[model samples]
Target: MSLLLGVASLSACAQSPAPERANGGKGTTPATSADAPAVEAGTPDARALAAIRTINEEIKVDRIAAAPLPGFREVVVGGQVLYVSDDGRYLVQGTLYDVKDKKDLSQVGLSVVRRELLDTVPTKDRIIFAPPSPKYTVAVFTDVGCSYCRKLHQEIAEYNKQGIAVEYLAFPRMGVASEDFKKMEAVWCSQDRRKALTDAKNDRKVVAKQCKNPVRMQYEIGQRAGLTGTPMIITESGVQMPGYMPPEALRAALDKLAAEGEAGPGAAVAGGH
Candidate 1:
């Protein structure tokens, strides 16, 4: 039996691009039609071709393989995990649940990808709010004009107090060369990036300046990650949670995730964008 998992949308507080849906349920879904071949163990290059057919400038396909559950092939495209039938015709988008193991297997694959990609972002490109003894850290894709992003920044101290370090990655809602993008550049180029980020988030004036900044690179990264909203959170363990979260609630979620990481692997695969 194949199960269809439901994907929820964030409020106006956050939005995403045209990425496929993800399933998170107790039952595993079938990727292939009844007439198609069953899934077999394989690599991304082999399995990815089966589904996407061709990889070009667009339709980024990361990897593909037999899912943890039988009968389904796992495909990662546009930074999201989707499943395809062995024939590559049938496609399923949702978090895959391995009921036998009582685990969310889809998250396991995504978290791995997020961690690897996030590691590529340099510290010089980010504005960090860190605590001396941080229990956990979250990287946020933020826009100066985003209200939810502002709300999150307003509680920066509270989050720091909870041992949750917040790293600000410039993700102007507007695409490059727009006013929002320029404003972000000003903040990054400021003498004190931390203060400039705070001021900008608070609607204070940002002295216009120019310098090589990662504002564009961060936006591109966000796009690849299917980031369509502000205040998008990526935990240290690579669990992505979208939209605004109050400090206490954020802390609890981070704490629970950190504890689960200690359990290792599948235990930390529940959260994704």
Candidate 2:
């Protein structure tokens, strides 16, 4: 079960042609056929959970429920999901795809987790660029020094024009100890955050200053959210669109999600940059 023991605390730096859903979750839900055996409800027995804990004490078992596969339980650890046998002797760490429905069961659960975490962040902590009456809002994990992040910022106005509000959260692809992180801190500390961010993105020197800021907290949140790179976009419904998209394309994707309703997996856009 060591496979269930790890998680990299960490985007798409390159551009992907289409929108894609990041691996995520929706909580305990049945993923089997009508003829399948009835799934065991409630939490797994102590012995099973204990067996999993023995693999990694640092692994905090958040939730355990019946999985799509028989004799296995879906365990949510950190921001990722793992499928562990009811006996806890076997563990599987990968996406559970519903080939028939064309859905990612793993992402279904993680999406709820991601949405819960993202909701805790208040507007005061974000650098927002929005029209007076926006149609859609997206929170983006970004690094001031990242090229793709800069490209996204360059099109901020167009995104707003498309009725998309952009809220920026610092991720600084390099670890928090890097110079890029410092630049982000500077941007967050400036008197006019929007201008400071635009200036930094445009390669202009921002005044080096320090203050109590959300840059580090936001970066840590990004790490927990499974962000691998800068410019990772999270929709209002918790669907993630990795990489960069032009304003018009982004508006269209958001529109699709809106039309599909909450049950639709907005993540089907594009991936693999």
Candidate 3:
């Protein structure tokens, strides 16, 4: 169930074919133009599968369903959504917009996938800071080394006061081998995770410890979910609000979404800080 796709690199390959191993450096023969005709001779699904394999043989096809775009099939590779032509000759990566309805069809589709993925992480695996009776819950992908992540953590009390529960998921942008990952591991291993995380956010020295922890698993999950930055906030409804939002502003935005009865891609609100 690993969804860590290097789509960005794949997109780059589409423009200029990589000179390295055709099998993505896995020592296997890469698919070429000659392979296309044979793949096309098979079923559309087979052809689509072959086409994506040509891009990255390691790509895991999670789901394949009808796309919002006609004559295209939506393929969920890992957690990233891709639109493939019915003929399986074409592949699209990026936002698929519905101009008439003013919606991002790709994100709308991704929201569902995200929710499903997040649901797999049990409550015990998360580091939650919540009110006695929370009104809204947001899963925040955070890195302790990230400044904005620290800023957000500094206001954990405020967020809780606003009746918005913050459930933290580790996302060490520096990778698992980095010091930040070890720091997070120590935090999770601590007897009091909330206190440890707060102390780490404040740049306090945390006694390093190791134990069975979800830091690495959560980091991989974030990778699968196509997370590009820290402080990425995802609502219970799976709408992503990237960047940091102040306590009051965040509560207001949540209220606005609730009032409007919407939590789609269009409902996503961005904040500079």
- Strongest candidate by lDDT: 3
For 1-273, candidate 1 gives per-residue lDDT tens digits of 222223333632443333222222211222211212234546443454555653332354544557775666776655577776665556677767767766677866667666655677878878999899887778898989888888888899999998888988877776664687789989999999999988888889999998876776677666555465777788776777746889998887767666666222234566453
Q: Could you tell me the lDDT of residue 147 within candidate 3?
A: 78
Estimate the TM-score for candidate 2: 0.78
The C-alpha TM-scores of every prediction are 0.78, 0.78, 0.79
Residue 16's lDDT in candidate 1: 34
Over 197-273, each residue of candidate 2 has an lDDT whose tens digit, in order, gives 99988889999988877776676566555565668887876676746788998888877767666413344321111
lDDT of 1: 0.67
lDDT of 3 by residue, 1-273 (tens): 223333322101111112111222111221111222233345666667776887888665655667878888777664477888988788887677767866667766566656766877879979999999998899998888777888888899999999999999877667655688789989989999888988888889889999887776676566555565677778877776646788998898888767765543335422111
lDDT of 2: 0.67
List ranges where model 3 is wrong by over 4 Å. 1-46, 263-273
The deviation in Å at residue 255 for candidate 3 is 2.2
Overall lDDT per candidate, in order of appearance:
0.67, 0.67, 0.69
Off by over 4 Å in 1: 1-12, 15-47, 54-57, 98-103, 262-268
Q: Give the residue spans of candidate 2 off by over 4 A.
A: 1-11, 14-42, 45-52, 60-63, 263-273
Model 2 sits at a Cα RMSD from the real structure of 8.8
